[model samples]
Target: MQMSQLVLKTLREAPSEAKARSHQYLLRAGYIRRLSSGIYSYLPLGLRVLAKVSNIVREELDSCGSQEILLPALHPVEIWERSGRIKKMADVLMKVEAKSGDFVLGPTHEEAVIEAVYQDLSSYSDLPATVYQIQTKFRDEPRSRYGLMRTREFIMADAYSFDSDQEGMRSSYSKVYDAYNKIFAKMEIPFEPVEADSGAIGGDVNHEFMSPAEIGEDYYAKCSSCGYRANIEAATRGSKDADAQGVGSELPELLYHYTPEAPGVEKAVEAISDLGVPTKAHEMLKCLVAIDGDQRLVMLLVPGDREARVPSGMRLLEDPEFERYPYLHKGFIGPMNAKENSIYVVADLSVKERSHFATGGNKAGYHVTGAVLGRDFQVDEYRSLVVVRDGDPCPRCGSALTLIRSVEIGHTFQLGLYYSSILENARFTGPDGQQYPYYMGCYGIGVTRLIAVIAEHFLDDRGLIWPVSVSPYQVVVVPLGAARSKEIEEVAETIYSGLLKDNVEALIDDRKLSPGVSLADCDLIGVPYQVVVGSKSLKEGQVEIKVRRDGTTTKMPIEEVPTRIRELLGRSL
Candidate 1:
C-alpha cells in the first residue's frame, strides 16, 4: 500500500480523552477513529490489523475442528427469554424494538446459535460439532472508556461446541484451551490462564486468558514462585493453622451492652475494649446484608485480629435476583432477630470454627460479646467467604499468592449442560434409545481487545511494536524525501515491488513527507521491518534498514534490500 493513496492521517498529538496507550497510539497512528464513547470506525490500517487477528484466530479454530459461520447480529427476544437470559441480562444486553415487537442486538450468540442448531441439526450423528464466528458484538456498557478494552460495540470471535455428553465436552474444551495457548503464543502476548467465574453467562467452570496491564479491570492473583494463577473470585487460599489456644473454660456469657453512636466495626470493637471485655473472648459477627427479593443476612465471624470484607464468589449485589430482596437494611443489619423466613443467613468458613466474639446487637448503638457460632447462632451454610489477600498462601503450592491486575483477552468454559438443558438442545438415540440435551463448551476471544492487549504489552514510548504474526504489514519501505527526488523514489519502488514479488507484505511510503515524519509514522504504525531510502543513503548506493522493536539500524546495499527484508520477515512470520 502506498502512503499517498492510503487514508493515512498521522497526528502529532493524541486526543485528550484517550486514557490508554493503545487508544492514544491507535488514534494518532490513524488506525481507528472514534464514532461515539465506545464505538469506533476502523480505518484502513486498523481494518488490516483486525483482519490479521481474525486470520490467526481462524487458523486456530479450524485446527480445533471448528467450522466458521456467521450468525445474525439482530436477534429475536424470544430466543433470549427461552434461554432465561433476557431478565438476567436486562442491563448489559442491548434491546431494541422492531416494527412488530421487541428484539436485542446480539451480545453473544449462544441463544441464537443454539436455537438454529436445534432446528436444523439433531440426532447423535450430528453430535459433537463446533461452530464459530468472527463477528461484531454489541453491549450496552454503562461507562465505555479506554478504547477497545471496554467498548460498547466491538468485534469478537466466539465459538460454541455441542457434544453428546460431558466426556465429549471435556474433550472439546481441552482442544480449545490448547488452541488458545498457541494463538496467544503466536500473537507474542504473555498471558496467564486463570480460573474465572461465569458471570451472567451461567456455567460450571470457566478460565480467563489474562495479560498483565495497569489499566485492567479484573484483579487476578499469581504465586511468585509456584506460578499458580487464578481470578481472585475463583482463587483459593491455603489453610492457616489457627492458634491452638484451647477454648477457655471460663467462657463469658453472652451479654448485650448499650453502645451509643458506634455503628461500624472499629467503633464497636473500641467500645467493647472500653468495657474491659477480652477481645479473644468475643467473636466479631459482622452482619452483611444482601437483597435477593427481601433483606437476607450474610454473617461473617472473623477473629478479633483479622478484618473481614465481602468474598468475591458470593453473589450478593451483582445477582439479578437481589432486586427482589430490597428490604435488607444496609449498615444496621444483624443475625439475631428472627424475621419469620425474611432472612437467609450464610456464614464464612472462618466464622464456623471461631470461638466467642463480639456481634451486632440487632439495634442501633449496641453490641453483644462472647457470642459463639453453633451456640448463639447456627449458620445456614459454610462457604470460603474471606477475600484472599496478598501474602496469603497459594492453594496449589504452599507459596504466597500475589494479586495482579490483568485484562481478559479470552475465556474458555466447560459449560456442561448449562445452555443445552435450558434451551432443550438435545439429540436422539443410542443403543439404549434414550434422548438427552447436548453437553456444551463455550470459548471466546475478544478479537479487538487482544489487539489492544498486544499493543499494551509490546509498545514503547514511540508507539506499538506489533508482533509479526499479527502485524498489518510484514515490512514497510519508506523513501525519505522521495516526493522531490526521483532516484530515492525509484529505489523504494524497486524494493517494494521485489518484496511483493517475494510474497512479503510491504507498505511503500511515497508521501511528500520529511525523513523524521516518515520514520516517526513508520514506528507509530509498528511494522517490524523498515527499509529507508534517503538522498544521503541513496547517494552511497545503500539504504538504511531499521528494526522497529529495538531501534537497531543497519546499512544495506540497494540491491540487497529486498533479500534482507524478506529474510528477517520470513524468520519472524
Candidate 2:
C-alpha cells in the first residue's frame, strides 16, 4: 500500500482524552478516530487489525464445528421481556423508540438466536449444535473510557450452543473452552481463565478469559497453592463458619455514647474505644443500607475495615432512595428491628460470630458498643460473604490468593435453559419424545477489545507491537532514498511486490518523506518486520532488515532480501 494514497494520518501528539497506552498509540498512529464518548471510528489500519482478529476468531470457531449465523440487532422488547432481562439489563441496554414499537439494540443474542433455533430444530439428532456470529454489538456503557477497552458500540463474536441434555451442553462448552485457550495462545497474549458471575445472562457457571494487563478494569484472584481462580464477585474465602461466641439468655445493656464528630465507622470505633471500651477497627461493624431490585432497603454489615461490594442486579441506595427511607439516619445507619420500616437485614457471616461488636445506634451522633449479634440484630439467613482483598484465603487450598488485575477478553457461560425456557415457543423434543427446554451455553469474545488488549500487551515505548497473527501488515517496506531516488524506489517496490507475491501483507512507504520520519511511523504502525532500502546499505550490495518487536537489524545481500524476509517472517516467498 502506498502511504500517499492511503488515508493514513499520524498525529504528533495523542488526543487529550486518549489516556491508556493502547488508546494513546492507536490515536497517535492514526488507527482510530474518536466518534464520541465510548465510541470510535476505525481507520484503515484499525480495520485491518479488526479483520485479522475476526478471521482468527472465525477460523477457531469453525474448527470447533460451530456454524456461523447473524442475528438481528434491532430486537423487539418483547424478547428481552420474555427472557426476564428487560428490567435486569435496563441500565446498559440501549432502547430505541421506533414507529412500529419499542426496540433494543441487541447487546447479546440469547433470546433471538434461541427463538429462531427452537422454531426449526428438534429431536436428539439436532441436540448439540453451536452457532456463532462475528458482528457488532451495542451497550450503553455508563463510563466508557480506555478507548476500545470499554466502548458503547463494538464488534464481538458471540456463540450460542443448544443441547438435548446438560451433558451435551458440557461437551459443547468444553470444546469452546479449549478453543479459547488456543485462540489466546495464537494471539500471543497472556491470559487466565477465572470463574466469574454470569450477571444478567443467567448462568450458574461461567469462566472469563482475562488478559493480564497493567490498566485492566477487572480484578481476579488466582490461588498460588491449588490454582483456584475466580473473579472477585464470585470468589470466596477458605475459612469455615464464623464463630457465634455462644450467647446466653441474659444480655448486657448496649452502650450507646454521644459521638457527634464520628460519622463513619472508623471514626466511631476510635471514639468508642476512647470512652473506656477496648476496640479495634476489625472489631467494629459497619452498617449500610442498600436498595435491592425490588426497591426495598436491605441492611448489610461488614467489618469496619472492609469495603462493601455490590454485585449485579443490586445497587447502593442513591439520594432519592435515601429520601424514601427518611427514618433511617443518613451516614449513621444500623441494623435495627426495621421490619416495620420495610428494611430487611442481611449481615456477613463474619458478623454472626463476633460478640460485643460495635455499630451505629441508628441515631445521629450516637454509636453503640457491646452490640451482640442475635441480641441486637438478626438476619433471615447467614450468607458466606467476605470482602475481597489482596492475599485473601483461597477457596480451594486455603492458601493466600493474590488479586490480579486483568482485561476480560472472552467469557463462556453454562446458560442452562435460561433463555430457551423463558422465551415463547422455545422447546425441543428429546430422545424420549418428551418436550423439554433446551440446554444452552453462551460464549463471547470482544473483537475490538482484543485489539486494544493486544496492543497493550505486545507494545513498547516506541509504539504498537502487533503479534504476527493480528498485525495490520506483516512487513513494511521503508525506501530510505527520497521518492526521487529511482534506485531506492525500485528496490522498495520490488521487495513489496515480492512480499505480495508470497501472499504476505506489506506496506510500502513510498511517500516523499525523510527516511527518519517514515521509519518512525513504520515503528509506530507496528508492522512485524521492516525492509529498509537505504543508499548506505545499498552501496554495500545489501538491504537492511529491522525486526519490530526487538530492535535487531541484519544486513543481507539485495539479491537474497526477499527470501530472507520470508525466512525472518517465518513465511515463504
Candidate 3:
C-alpha cells in the first residue's frame, strides 16, 4: 500500500476522554473513529488488523473440524421467549419493532444457532455437528469503554456444537479448547484459561481465556504454588475447620454497647476503641442485608475485612427496600436477630473459625460485643460466599493465591442441554428409538476486541506495538526525502515491490513529508519492521533495517533487502 494515497490522517494529540493507552493510540494512529458511545467505525488499517485476527480464528476452528455457518443477527423475539432468555437477558437485549413483528438484535446466537441446526441433525448418526460464524453482534452495554474492549456493536467469531450426550459434547469442547490455545498462540500474546462462571449464558461449566493488562476490568486468582487459576466469580478458597482457633473454651455472654454515632463498621470500631477495647476490622462481624427476587430479606454474614459475593437473583438492600422492612437498619444490620425478624441468615465459611465477634446491636447507632456464634446467633447455612483475595489459600492445593487484572479474550462453555432443551425441535432420535435433547457447547472470540487487546498488550512509550501476526502491514518502507531525492525514491519503490513479490505485506511511505514526521508515524503505527532507504545508507550500498519490537537496527546490502526481510519474518525467501 502507498501511504501518499491512503486515506488516513495521523493525530498529534489524542482525545481528552481516551484514557486507556490502546484507545488513545488507536484514535491518534487513525485506526478507528468513534461514531457514538460504545460504537466505532474501523478504518482501512483497523479493518485489516481485524481481518487478520478473524483469519487466525477461522483457520484454528476449521482445523478442528468445525464447519463455518453464519446465523442471523436479527432474531425473532418469540424465539428468545421460547428459550426463556428474554427475561434473563433483558438488560442487554436490544429490542426492535418491525412491520412483521418484534425482533431482538442478538448479543449472542445460542438460541438462533440451535434453531438453525435443529432439523439437520435429527438422528444419532448425524449427531456431534459443530458450526461457526464470524459476524457482528449487538448488546446494549450500559457503559462501554476502552475502545473495542467493551462495545455495544462489534464483530465476533461464535461457534456452537451439538452432540448426542454429555460425553460427546465434552469431546467437542476439548477440541475447541485446543483450537483456542493455538489461535492465541498464533496471536503472540500471553494468556491463561481459567475456570469462570457462565453468567446469563447458563452453563454448568465454562472457561475464560484471559490476558493480563493494567487496564483490564476483570480479575482472576492464580495459585502461586499449585498453578491453580480461576476467575474471581468462580474462584474458591481452602476450607478451615469449624472448631479452628479464636474459639474460647468459655465464651462471654453477648452484651449490647451504646454507640450513638456508629453508622458503619469503621465508625463502630472507632466508638468501641474509644471505650479502651482494641479491635480490628476483621474482628467485627459484618452483616449485609439483601433481598431476593421474591422480596425476602436475607442476611449475609462475613468478616468485616471481606466482601460478600452477591448471588444471582439477589441484590443488596437499597434505601427504598429498607423502608419496606422498618425493623432492618440500613447500616446497622446484624445476624443475631435475623431469625426473630424472619430473615434467613447465611454465613461465610470463614465465620466458623471465629467464635466471638463485635456485631451490630440491630438498632440504629448501637453495637454489641462478646457475641458468640452458637450462643447468640445461629446460621441457617454456611457458604463460600466471600470474594477470593490475594493470599487466600487455593481450594485445590492449599497454596497462596495471587490476583491479577485481566481482559477476557475468549470463552468456552459446556452448555449441556441448556439451550437445546428450551429451543424448538432440538432433540435427536437415539438408537433405542427415544428422543433426547442434544448436549451443546458454545465458544466465542471477540474479533474486533482483539485488535485493541493486542495493541494494549504489546506497546511502548511511543505507541502501539502490534504483533507481526496481526499488524496491518509487516514492513513499512520509508524513503527519507523521497520526493526530493529521485535515487532514494527509486530504491524504496524497488525494495517495496520486491518484498510484495515475495508475499511480504509491505507499505511504502510515498508522501512528501519530512523524515522525522514519516519515521515517527511509522513507529506510531507500529509496523514490525522499517526499511530505511536514505541517501547516506545507499552510498554504502546498504539499507538500514529497523526492528520495531526492540528498536535494533541492522544494515544489509540493498540487493539482499527483500530476502533478509523474508528471513526475519520466517518466510521462504
Candidate 4:
C-alpha cells in the first residue's frame, strides 16, 4: 500500500491511560485506536497483523482434523441456564434484555456448541468429532487495561472435541494439546505450559500455556527438583502434620491464656512469650471465616506461618459480611466458641503436625497457650490447603519452590460430561443401544491478546519488534531522499512491486516525508526488514537493509534485497 494514500498517523506521545510499554507503542505507532475503556478498533496496519494471526490458527487447527464452525455471539439465556453457568459466571456474563425475552452475549460457546452438535449426532457411528471457530467473544471485565491484554470484547479461537468414550476423549485432548504447542512455536513466542485450575469451566484436568512477563497478573510456582509447575490456584503445599501418634506429644496439655492486646499470630506469640509461655509461630493455628455460596460461615484453621489459602472452588466472603454474625470476632477468632452451630469448622492438613499449637481465644484479650487439635476442638475435615510459600518443599521431590509472574495465553480442559450432562439433549446412543453423554475437551487461543503479548515480549526501546510470522508486513521499503531523487523512488517502487509479485508482503514509504520521519515510522511499526534506498548507497551499486530485531544492517544489490528478506523469513513468498 502507498503511504501517501493510507490514513495513517504516528503519534509522538502515548495516551495517559496506557500502562504497558507495548500498549504505549501500539498507540504511538498508529496500529490501534481506543474506542472506550476496554474496547478498541484495529487500524489498517493492526488488521493486517490480526489477519496473519487468524490464518495461522486456521492452518494449525485444520491440519489436526478439526472442523471449523462459527457460532453466534448472541445466545439465548436458556442455554447458559441449562448448563448451570448462568449462576456460576453471573458477574462476567453479559446479559441483555429484549422485548421478546432475555439474551446473553456469550463469553464462551460450550453450551451453544454442544446443543448444536448433539442434535444431529444420535448414533455411535459418529463416535469422535471436533469443531472449532475463530470468532469474537465478549465478557464484562470490571477493569480492562493494558490494551488488548485485558479487553471486554476480543477475537478468540475456541475449539471443542467430543468423543464416545474416555479413552477417545484423552486422545482428542492430546491432539489439541500438540496443536497448541505448534501454534505458539510457529508464532515464535516463548511460553510455558503449566498445570491449571479449571475454574468456572467445570472441568477435571486442565493446562494453561503461560508466557512469562514482568507485568503479568497470574502467579505460578515451579519446582526445580521435580519440574512440577502449576498456577497459584492449582498449587498446593502438604499439611505439616499428616501423621501423628498422640496429641501434644512435645507439650503436656492444652492451656488457656489471657493476652490483652494481641490479635495476630506474630503479636500473640510475642505477648505469650512476654508472659513466659514458650511457643514458636509455626506451632499456632490461624483462624479465618469465609461465607460460602449459601451464606454460611465456613471456618478455616491454617498453620500460623502460612497465609490462609482459600480454594478457588469456593469464594471467600468480604469484611462487610462479618457484621451479620456478631458471634464471630473480626481478628481474634476460633472454632472453640464460634457461637451456637452457626459455623462449620475445617482444618488444614498442616495443622495436624502442630501437636501443641496456639489458637485464637474467640474472645478479645484472650488466647489459648497450648491447644491440641483432636483434644481441644475437633475439625470436620483436614485438607491440603496451605498456600505454597517461596521456600516451601516441593510436593513431589521436596525441593524449594520458585515463584514467577506469567501471562495466561492458552488453556485446554478435559471437560468430561460437565456441560453435556447438564445441557438438555446433549446425549448420543451407544453401541449397546443405551444413551450416553459425550466426553468433551476445550482449547482456546486469545487471537487479539496475542498481538499485545508478542509486542510486549519481543520489543526494544525503538518500538514493538514483532516476530516475522505475525509482523504486519514482512518488509518495508523506506526510500531515503525519495522526493529529492527520482532514481531512488523508481528503484524503491520497482523493488516493492517485485516483492509483491513474488507473494511477499511489502510496504513502501512513497510519501514526501523526510528520511528520518520515514525510518522512525518504520522502526515503530516494526516490520521485520527495512530497505533504505539512499543516494550514496545507490551510487555504490547497493542499498541498505536493516533487520529490526537485532538492528543488523547489510549492504546488498537492489535486486537481491527481496531475496534476502524471503530467506530471513524462512518461507516461500
Candidate 5:
C-alpha cells in the first residue's frame, strides 16, 4: 500500500470520550470512528486489522472440524420463547417490533443453530457436529460506556457443538478449549483462563479467557502462590470459625427499644453507642428481603459487619420463577411480621452464630436490642452468604487472593443438555431404541474485543505496537525526498517490489511529505520494520533500517535491504 493513495489521518490528541488506552489510540490513529455510544465504524486501516483477526479465527475453527456458516441476525421471538430464553434474557436481549409485531436481534445463535441442526440431523451417525460463524451481535446494554469494552453492538465468533452424550460433550469441549488457546496465541495476546459463571446461558461449568488491564470492568481474584483464578462473584473465601457455642444462652434477655431516625447500620451503631449500649455485648442482625415474585419474599439475615452475597448460579431474575415481579425495593426493605405464607425467612451462618443482636422491631421508630439468635428468633438456613473480599484466603490454597481487573475475550461451557432438553434435540441408536437428549458445549470468542485487548497490552505512548502475527503490514518503506529526487524514489520502489516478491507484506510511503513527517507517522503506526531511503543514506549507497518495537537502527547497503528485511521478518514471524 502507498501512503499517497491511502486516506490515512493521524491525530495530535486522543479523543476525550475514550476511557481506555486502546480506544483512544484506535480513534487517534484513524482506524475507527464512533457511530453511537457503543457502535463504531471501521475505516480502511481498522478493517485490515479486523480482517486479519477474522482470518485467524476462521483458520482455527476450521481446524476443529467446525464448518463456517452464516446465520440470520434477525430471528423470530418464537424460537427464543421455545428455548425459555425470551423472558429470561429480557434485559440484554435486543427486541424489535416489525410488521409481524415481534422479533429480536440475535445476541447469540444457540437456539437458532440447535433448531436448525435438530431439523436436519437427527441420527447417531450425525451425532457429533460443530458449526460456527463470525458475525455481528446485538446486545441492549443499559449503560454502554468504556468504548468497546461493553458495547451494545459488536462482532463475535460463536460456535456450538452437539454430541450424543456427556462423554462426547467433554471431548468436544476440550477440543474447543485447545483451539481457543491457539487462537489467542496466534493473535499474540496474553490471556488467562479462569472459572466463570454461566450467567443467563444456564450451564454447568464455564471458563473465561481474561486479559489483565487496569481499566477493565470485570474484577477477578487470583492466587499468587497457586494458579486458582475466578470471577469475584463466583470466588470462594475458604472458611472461618464461628463463635456460636461460646456465648451462653442466658447472657442477655431480648428487649425492644424505641429508636427512630436510624435507617442504616452505621447510623444505628452510632445511636446504640450514644445510648451507652456495650458494642461487644450485643451483635447486629441486618434484615433484608429477597423478594422473588409478588407472592413470595425470602427474608435474608446477615451480620451487620458483613454484606449479603448472592450466588452467581442462582439467576433469579433470569429464571421463570421470578418473572411476575420485576420491581422490588432495594434499600428500604426489611423483615416485618411474616405475612400469611407470603414470605420465607433465611439467615446467614454468620448471623446464626451471634448470641445477642439488634434487629428491627417490625414497626416504625422501634428496634430490638440484646436479641439472642436462638432465643429471640429462629430461621431456615445457615449457609455461605458473605461476599468474598480482597485478601481473603483462596479455597484451593490458603494463599491470600489478589483482585485484578480484566477483560473477557473468550468462554467455553459444558452446557449439559440444557438447550437440548428444551429443543428436543435428541437421537437414538440403542438396543431398545430409547431416545435421549443430546449434550452440548458452547464456545465464544470476541474477535473485536481481542483487538482492543491486544492494543491495551501492547502499546507505547506513540501508538499501537502491533504483534507480528496480526500486524496489518510487516515492513514499511519510507522514501525521503522521493517527491524531489528520482534516485530515492527508484531505490524505495525497487526495495518495496523486492519485498513483495519475497512474500513479505510491505507498505511504501510515496507521499509528498517531509522526511521527519514520514518517520513520525511510521513510528505512530508501529510497523515492526522500517526501511528509510533518504538523500543522505542514498548518497552513501545505503538505506536506514529501524525496528519499531525496540529503537534499533542501522545502515544497510541498498542491495542488502531486501535480504535483511526478509531475515528480520522471518525470525519474528
Candidate 6:
C-alpha cells in the first residue's frame, strides 16, 4: 500500500462524543468513522486488522476439527418462539416484517444452526460435530459507548458444538476451550479466564475471558492466596456461623427511637451518631423488599456498605408494589416485624455473626438499636446475598479478594441439553431405538471489539502501539526528501518492494512530506516497524529501522531491513 493512495485522513482532534481513550485514538488515527450513536464503518486500515484476527481464529478452530459455516443473519421468528427465547430476549431482538413473514436480525446463531443441522445429525453416528462462523450480529443495545466495545452491529466469531452424550460434550468443550486460549494468545493481550454467569444464554457452566482495562464495564474478583477467580456476579465469599443457637432462641429486645430526618441509610447513620452511637455503614442493617418467582413477598437483609443481589427469578418491589403493600415502608422496612406481616426474611451470612444491628423500626421516621439477628428478628434463611467487595474473604481459602475492572473479550459455555430439549427436531436416535437431545457447547469471540481492546492495551501518550500480530501493517517505509532527493526515494522504494517480495506486509510513504510529519504519521498509524530512508542514512549505505513499540532505531543495510522485520514479527508471534 502507498501512503499517497491510501484512503484515510488523520484528524487533529477526536469527535466530541468519543470519551474512551481508545475510541478517541481510533477516530483520530483514521481507522474508523462513526455513522451513528452505536454504528461505525471500518476504513481500510481497520478492516485489515479485523481480517488478521479472523484468520487467526479460523486457523485455531480449523486445526481442532471444527468446520466453518456461515449462518443466516435473518432468522425466522418461529425458531426463536419455539425455543422460548422470543419473550426472554424481547428487549434486544430486532424484529422485521417482510413480504414473506416475520423475521429477526440474529443476535446469536444457536437456533438457526440447530434448525439447519437437526435433520442431518439425526443419529449418534454423526456425533461430536462443531461448526463456526465469522459474521455480523445485531443487537438493540440501549447504551452503546466506548466505540467498538459495545455497538449495535459488530462482527463476532461464534462457534457451536453438538454431541450425543455428556462425556462427548465435555470433550468437544475442552477442544474449543483450548482453541480460545490459542486465539487470544496470538492476539498478545493480557486476559484472564474466570467463572462467569450464563446470563441470557442459559447454560450450566460458563467462563468469560476478561481483559483488564479502566474503561471496562464488567468486574471480576480474584483471590490472592488460592488463585480462585470468578465474575463478580458469580463470585462467592466465606460465610460465618450464627452466634446464637437458633432463630428466636434469645430475647434481645429492640430499643426504638425517633429519627425524623433519617430516610436513607447514610442519614440513619448520622442520626444514630447523634444519639452517641458511632456506627459505620456496615454496622447498620439494610432491608430490601422483593417478590420472588412464586409471588411471595420477601425481605432481603444486607449491610449498608454492600449491595443486595436479587436472586434469579425474583425482582425488587416497584412503585405499584410499594403502594400495594403499604405496611412495607420504603426506607424504614425491617425484619423485626416480618413474621407478623407474613413476609419472609432472608439475611446475609455476616448478619448471623453480628451481635447487634441499628436497623429500620418498621415505621417512618424511626429506627431501633439493640436489634439482634437471632433474637429480635428471626431470619428464615441465611445465604450469600451481598456483592463481594475488595477485602471480602475468599470462598475457597478465606483469603482477601481483589476486584478487577475488565471487558469481556470471549466466552465459553457448556450449554448441556437445554437448547436441544426446547427446540423441536433437535434430538438424535440412540442405539436402543430411543431419541435423546443433543448436548451442546458455545464459544464466542468479539472480532471488532478486539480492535479497541488491542488499541487500549498497547498505547502511549503519543499514539497506539499495536503488536506485530494484529498491527495494520507490519512495516511502514518513510522516505525523507522524497521530491528533492532521488537517492532517498530509490532506497525506500527498493526496501518496500523487497519486503513485499519477501511476503511481509509493508507500506511505502510516497507522499512528499517533512520527516517529522512522516514519522509522526507512521507512529500514529501504529505500524510495528518503520524503515526510515533518509538522505544521510542512504549516503551512509544504510537505512534506519525504528521500532515503534520501544522507539529504538538501528541503522542497517537496505537489504537487511526485510529479513530483520520478518524475524521480529516471528518472535512476537
Candidate 1 global CA lDDT score: 0.79
On TM-score, who's better, 4 or 6?
6
lDDT score, residue 535, model 5?
88
Instruction: Give candidate 5's whole-model lDDT.
Output: 0.77
Please give the distance, in angstroms, between residue 454's alpha carbon in candidate 1 and its true position after superposition.
1.2
- Which candidate gets the maximum lDDT versus the true structure? 3
Task: Give the winner by TM-score: 5 or 6.
Answer: 6
In order of appearance, the predictions have TM-scores of: 0.90, 0.90, 0.91, 0.91, 0.89, 0.91
Model 4 lDDT per residue over 122-219, tens place: 77798789899998999999999899999999999999999998899999999989999999888887898888889988788899999988978887
Regions of model 2 farther than 4 Å from truth: 240-244, 247-253, 258-267, 270-280, 288-300, 310-349, 362-366, 373-383, 571-573
Give, for candidate 4, the lowest lDDT window spanning 10 residues: 239-248
- Model 2, 1-573: lDDT tens per residue? 888888998987898998898999999998999989989999999999999889889888999989998888889999888878888888999999989999999999888897777766777677688999987899999999899999999999999988888998999999999889988888898999999988878777799998888899888988878889888877776654456665675555688888889888778878887888867888888777777768777777777887776654567777666666667777677776566676777666666556667778788888887777767666654553565778766767778989998899999999987777666566887777888888889999999999999999878888998889999888988888455478888888888888899888888988888877888899899988998989888888888998888889999998797788778778511
Deviation in angstroms for 439 in model 1? 0.5
lDDT of 3 by residue, 160-255 (tens): 999998999999999999999999999987899999988888778899999999999999999978889999998877766555334466776677
Q: Give per-residue CA lDDT, model 1, range 1-573, as digits (tens).
A: 887898989898999989899889999999899988999998998889899999999999999899999999999999999988898788889988889889999999888788767755577777779989998899999999888888999899999998888898889899989999999989988888998878777687789998989999978988988888888767767655442234466766778887776676677777777888744323566776554433444445444445444543343554454455544333334566533434556665566455666877766567888665545665676655556778877777768889988899999988887777777664545446677777888889999988788888878999988888888888899888735588778888999999899888889988887778888899998999898888887788999999988989999798887778767877886
Candidate 5 residue 119 C-alpha distance from true site, Å:
2.5
Model 5, span 1-573: residue lDDT tens: 897777778887877888788888888777788898889888877888889899999999899888898888989999998988988889899889998778899999888887666755566677788889998999999987666677888899999888888899899989889999999988888788888878788788889998888878887889989999987667666644555543474578666665687666776666666777745322677766555435356777777777667654331233353345433223223344433335566766556456667776665556667665555565666655666668877777778889888888999999988887777554445335667777888889988887788888878877788887877789999998636588888899999999999988889998888777788788777678899888898888999999888888999899998788878877876
**Model 6 lDDT tens row, 347-448:** 888886677788998898888887876677888997778889899888888888999999999999999987988887889999998999999999999999
Model with the higher lDDT, candidate 2 or 3: 3
Clashes of each: 11, 0, 0, 3, 0, 0
Against the true structure, candidate 2 reaches a TM-score of 0.90
